[model samples]
Target: AQSVSQHNHHVILSEAASLELGCNYSYGGTVNLFWYVQYPGQHLQLLLKYFSGDPLVKGIKGFEAEFIKSKFSFNLRKPSVQWSDTAEYFCAARSTGFQKLVFGTGTRLLVSP
Candidate 1:
């Protein structure tokens, strides 16, 4: 079965610090990638997504992801993170012709003031 992996289980940073969360998928075929964020007590929200058009996709709240088909990677990046950015980040992938979306274990980010 295809799966997504987020290498960073937990990340801590001060406000205004740069952030980069790794996200890699195991599938080789064309896939739809997404980055979802869940705040402390809120439901998951779509942070960014790549469904083919451009490899680089800009998302909400200064978040962006790049889809490198050759590497099977869709890493999320933020130039400067804020305390409000503290949340659980999830990487998900759904191969073409598939109905299920495989999600990663998730990376918890705690940003301090």
Candidate 2:
């Protein structure tokens, strides 16, 4: 069975602070990685993804992540975050050509101005 686990359930941050959230999965085989963000009152949108190739990938809103195959981790990082970045972040993964996705419970990021 495959599953995702987020280290934090909620986080509070001040504007312009750096942010990093942990994500790990329990899968031994190949898989596609993704980070989806849902802004306040908005639908989920793709922040970034890792299908094949490089381990490091960048996404919209100055976000990036590195996929560590050995650790079974894909952690999200932002050098500096703004209040607008406040939202719920979900780490998801699925096997190649798999239709369904397994998502983490989610980490709520609250950035204060």
Best-fitting candidate, scored by lDDT:
2
For model 1, the superposed segments whose C-alpha errors exceed 4 Å read: none
Would you list the C-alpha lDDT of every candidate in the order shown?
0.95, 0.96
Off by over 4 Å in 2: none
| Candidate 1 per-residue lDDT over residues 14-33, each given as its tens digit | 99999999999999778999
* Superposition TM-score, candidate 2 onto the true structure: 0.97
Assess every candidate by TM-score.
0.97, 0.97
How well is each residue in 1-113 modelled by candidate 2, as lDDT tens digits? 89999999999999999999999998767899999999999999999999999999999989999999989999999999999999999999998788779999999999999
Q: Model 1: clashing residue pairs?
A: none
The 10 consecutive residues of candidate 2 with the worst lDDT sum are 93-102
* lDDT (Cα, 0-100) at 28 in candidate 2: 67
